[model samples]
Target chain A: MNIKHSLLNIFQDNPTCWQLILDQALYGYLISQKNSPENFYINPALQEHLKLLLTDFKSEEFSFEIKEPLEKSEAKSIKTEAYFFLNGKKIASKKAHFLSFSFQQEEFYIAVFSSEKITRANAYQKTYDVGLAEKLKISEKAFQNNFEYGATGMALVSLEGKWLKVNKRISLMLGYTKEELFKLTFQDITVPEDLEKDLSLLKRLLDGEIDHYQLEKRYYHKNGSIVYAILAVSIVKNNDGLNLYFISQLIDITEMKRAEKRIKKLFKKSKEQNERLENFAHIVSHNLRSHAGNFSMLLELYESQLDEEDEIITMLSSASSNLQETIEHLSEIVNMHNSIKNTMESIAVLPVAKKTIENLSSQIQQHNLKITLAVDASLKVKAVPAYLESIFLNFISNAIKYSSPSKASFLEVNAEVEDAFIRIDFKDNGLGIDLEKHGHKLFKMYKTFHEHEDARGIGLFLTKNQIQAMGGKIEVESAVDEGTTFSIYLKKTT
Target chain B: MSTLKLTCIIDDDPIYVFGIQKVMDVINFCESTLIFKNGRDALDNLSSIIENNENIPDVILLDLNMPIMDGWEFLDEFIKIPSPKKVYIYVISSSIDPKDVNRVKRYQDVKNYIIKPVGPEQLSTILKDFKEDNFS
Candidate 1:
């Protein structure tokens, strides 16, 4: 008959014998059958009872029925429930646990039994309960709202590089919705240049070589901007020793990257400005001083040459004039350098232009030049007051000085607001320059293009420097014998 | 009473050269004088003189700044020539910068650093030194 029928017969006919077999099984006694043998050693008193039962039931027909199929327990062992019977009568029920392991191609099953009536707790069962509680605590903590909503991004990725789950923070950090992100792989969002490194680290983890890895990598946001992050990844494995998914944590560092770029750019700009200042100082020390020293030596020589008094006097007078001119230029440059750190103020541009025109009224009247001003009286720019006046003065004086002798000269000044700058245009009908020939040196010190008595070649250079010191820029356009237009871009006062 | 046999003036400034020539006339500085507008001209002519086995000048008044081959470059090239007679070089420059003065000392052939408008007294002292050495 079936094992169940046989178990029922044993349980009914030999109830004491079934109890003795279960007692021995629970107390770590070996029960050998025709071809299979089982061993247990949980207790000693039950073993004596099982030994006596084994001798008495040796000739009796006995069988057992598994009431429940063997399945993996929470403690990582096979567990099942079974019933024993003799002469078609049920005698006992048992809960059996087996730890199946393999060594050298041989499979072994070590079983532990618990009787229905006896509530004996085994070490494996106790460990199983504690392990289950600890796992629940960890899962509960991980799924808490605080952890999911933290500032740092966290995600779970599959072994194939697809994102299985992502917290709200990671979704927001990448500028993608949760639903949209779930459809994409980690490789899709990673920057192409950083994907290779990430893949290699993942390979090591999948090969069971590393527990986790951390790296600084770039990710692409939904808007196609680069996002810098410190990425930490750890692999979670299943009981079969395979990767279930990856736990990834990313710390955003985009702001820090932008700040570093800004600092580097600022450092380079300041270095260039310092180099220019040093070159200017060298010119002042050598070029200007050499001319002055020559004058002093010539004057002393003239004292001994009494016969050629008039000729020597003329030479000395010319030398002194040149020296005086050089000194004035040097002083102007020094003044501009000193005022570089001057605080800016909102000054009306029209009034400054008017004042500069008034200062040059005599020259204008002498030349019979016509002047037109179209700037608004309320137009103001952020600049040093002294620099504003000086800039206007230089532009107006230059227009008058370079007036064309062929025709009566006219000056037109106007201002317009453009974006963040107030663009002031000074158009003069004068002897315009051939920009192709002199454009490069137009704002350089001591570079004279036109042969004019008043062209010291220092006005435009100083004006350019002054404008730059006030956070402004100057541009010029000219053609030979036509006219010149100077455009000054000044930062507008808010 | 002129102890100097020959003197050379290598300068680009005509006015300063004229002044020095007038002063030399008053002092009876040398029997003959040679002039070059720049250091390159002086170097080329002097090199040719050496090649031709001609008599070289006893003294050279060199100006530092010129159109081509400045005094420093001329000195650098001149020292390599194998000369039979010792030629003393005086660097006359309008630069009062101490760096220039120190640089002049680097050239062993350069005997003195004179500022512009070299007075008769300075020339007389240089002549006195030359006469004393010649006698000794």
Candidate 2:
């Protein structure tokens, strides 16, 4: 029985037995003081029983005896019993390990001291039985929060393509919630076109032939839209001797895909244009060359037969003039071909813009055009200086010539830094071409839209070719009546 | 039949063909000469000759540029023939393009690249390489 239980059992007796118990308790106390040694040594078993009875008496009012060093007598007394203290008093000095015995078998009273230290209750900690639960609770809360939310489309897959775990980013990228994502396998979501290659790469990874695999592949979104992604799958072994998992860092590259598609179309167009140019080169080399050779032959015949030439001197003169004109045309074409500017010289934008303005000073003042330049002054671009001047002069002259005579012409040239590219926008308030109808042939040679007699269509063609050769591109946005805006994207070399 | 019965001339330019003929006459070269404007016309005649098992052109003077099919294109198509026949192709042009000259030399069947304005000396050299007499 515990101490409280033994004490309670002693005090909870009936009134008829209360006085007897109290008297016995008093006798035990007095007898203990009188002959402490004799009391213990008289009956060896009875001394222990008497000590238990005295120890059972509840009250902290007893005077404790200072027993001297057990010099033979005290030591002999202890042979029959043990010594115990209660409430700073030697209440029981006996050998009894048992304190109280009840009439009912299950009601024995004994002292029970709880050895568990008291601390505040942690999460769901009802009893002191479980240790370090409070510390574990604090650490677990921190650990649970450590599994951060955004992780750039993370997917934890088994080596066999089973979806083990996935983060919120992957779920969002795949257009599925976490609950829905766990139910699907990677093979199910992978594009059929990329499945075989990805699986082969994954097999190589599992065999340790490769550390990881990164590829731009497509995944089926939950909404049936194709999501282009840069997928990097890394193999990770579990700390527990479980299966290896693949951590896929999928970056949604749908924008990159769109850009790629645009670039592919642009490349196809340029390739077709190059093929056309090759055909044109062949035509010029054949037909024009034959004409030139024929014109020279006619001269040779005239020189050989001067008497026949006197009769056809006017015809010969006209032929010679026509030949000269043809030669001039050929020379023009050759000059245009040779003037394909492709120098990668990095020059400050400020100086070039200032020179272009100065070169077009008369036209700018003549047309009374309001010009604004918001280019980054310290910005340097890699391009041929002559080509830049030609492009600027052509654009500025066109703006001056084609602008509305009613209102003052406005021109704006500005540059903004984009990732890996410098985008320069040249805006002009001028007679814009109908792009919806004629945009395809805007950069084609001999294609003209304006009624201006001097608008030779070669300027835009040469400009486009020059820009393309310098690793830049030009895109024009215009309406027939509104205005024209050229968005030129040039790669930043340095 | 022992001598060259028919020497063929294949060129789009009539003036160049006339000039070659005059040079050939000056050098007292082959009398029977055939003319073709482009590779397509020449290949057509050659293919017919091949089908009939007749005498094909001993020497083909090809130009790089033409209306239908150019010289290089015709050469690529012509080499696919299964028949075991000996033929020499010569590229004649005024094009000073070094790339074209180097490319023509890479063809195993091409004998030489001759620049235009053919003269008696050029014809004599070809006749000498053929190991034939000056006049046939």
Candidate 3:
């Protein structure tokens, strides 16, 4: 048979034959070189010797095959067994190849064999065939895709304050396109006030002193608006354990920040309102008790002073009237402060002022006041009906009460729209107050600046409280005896 | 028992002042009376009396809410005056607030807090206390 065809036939029959031949070839070469023996061959008588050789080699089985006829070999040989036995058990039964060579025209034959399982050896070799580079590239692509399309904004910034890479979400959050963001650094978009804090955190990260940090900071958007975000950053290192870059994650929190501000404002406003109410309560308690205590004491005196009956009676009546007036004043203040809600309406200012003036017509005529009404007939304001009537009555009557006695009194009522307010000015040529002496106490309850018996000190106090409850304000400009202008600002009804 | 040599009244309300004056006369509560509209006038008058070596009032009835220099401010300034006599001050105020009542404790010169209007009987009782205590 042809040598090439026989070798191919053996390989097709048992693919494990090549591994067996390579192992045996190495063992045979080492044994022959180390022993330095004469020419060696296999024979039936040397079969025991080959078994001994196999035992020395620590193999469980052995097999051999040759393409040339056994008779053509000049060296000693044995009838080649397809299976080799060790200790009375057939240990080797796989087909193997043989090599026939001549040294000085004497032929020699060497057989290759193995005793191990074929399947286990092939599994060990297959493990090394996997391409690690291709596997790494596939996994890296998956991670990169996740980072680029994440919902939260992610970025990698170098130690030199430059943005190396930024995800799509960061560009969208800052109102900039990806190309525009790449051209800018993190410092360019940071709010001026928040840049210092962000830089310090980054420094800490670069020093490897902290693993990560988070802070709420403001960033400037491309449109020049503020974007609030909770920024979290961590350090990533290179193979040499040196500073590489920073990985930053940002979450938008602008809406939540606005809600927090609104809540704080409301809390402050309510606190101020509560303080005012407490002051009002103290005033009521002090004023009312004083008057009632005086009345009771006077009535007690009336019993013992029967001899001066007329005088005692006059005193008692005056005390009673004073008590009545105080009670009325307290009630008016309580009503004004308590009726702040569900009572406001759009009332025509001209009609209200006219009616108020009509009610005080007798007082107006007594003062010899010339009244000029410049208020537009269609002007309206947001106020409670009774409060509007009371406010107008107080202003008109106050003008008459303090009218100048040296000259004929002149009164002017005018209204003009200003922004969201309807400003009504009640100008009068009256005995104006020395505001420097009494300005601080002008709106304080029971504070009297004038010596007039009817001043009662309650009109302006009530007027101020009522206007404030309706979301309005009152201001007075005056010089002593020069005349006073009381400007009332009320919310205009549209 | 000796009556009060002189008594000072510092208040702004005319009605309360009138009632107190009548009650004092009916009971002859003091030998003489000195009245002032507010704390500032009382402080000025008392300071002058000290300067002239005149006799200061044995007792002072002070009101809390006055036009100028209220009772608390008066007490703050009054204790610093170098006077020969120790004048007892009684706080006569219409305030029933516990805060005002508590504030009176801060003044060591204030002897008592009387609520308005001081009745005739209450005045007689105060005079009797002064007589028994010999204005100590």
For each candidate, what is the lDDT?
0.77, 0.66, 0.76
Best by DockQ: 3
Each candidate's interface RMSD (Å, one decimal) is: 5.7, 4.7, 5.2
Candidate 3 vs. true structure, TM-score = 0.47
Tens digit of per-residue lDDT, candidate 2, span A378-440: 676678787677777777777777777777789898988788778878798778889989999
The full ranking of all candidates by DockQ, starting with the best, is: 3, 1, 2
Model 3: runs farther than 4 Å from truth? Answer: A1-142, A145-151, A158-164, A204-212, A287-494, B1-5, B12-31, B37-41, B47-53, B66-69, B76-86, B105-109, B119-121, B131-136
Q: What TM-score does chain A of each model score against the native chain A?
A: 0.45, 0.38, 0.44
What TM-score do all the candidates reach, one by one?
A: 0.47, 0.38, 0.47
- Top candidate by lDDT: 1
Model 2 lDDT tens row, B23-124: 565556775677888888988888888778787666677878766877888889777775556665678765534456778988998878875545556666
Interface RMSD, Å, model 3: 5.2
Query: Candidate 2's C-alpha lDDT?
Result: 0.66
Model 2 iRMS (Å) reads 4.7
Please state the CAPRI-style docking class of candidate 3. Answer: acceptable
Clashes of each: 20, 11, 0
Q: RMSD of model 1, in Å?
A: 21.5
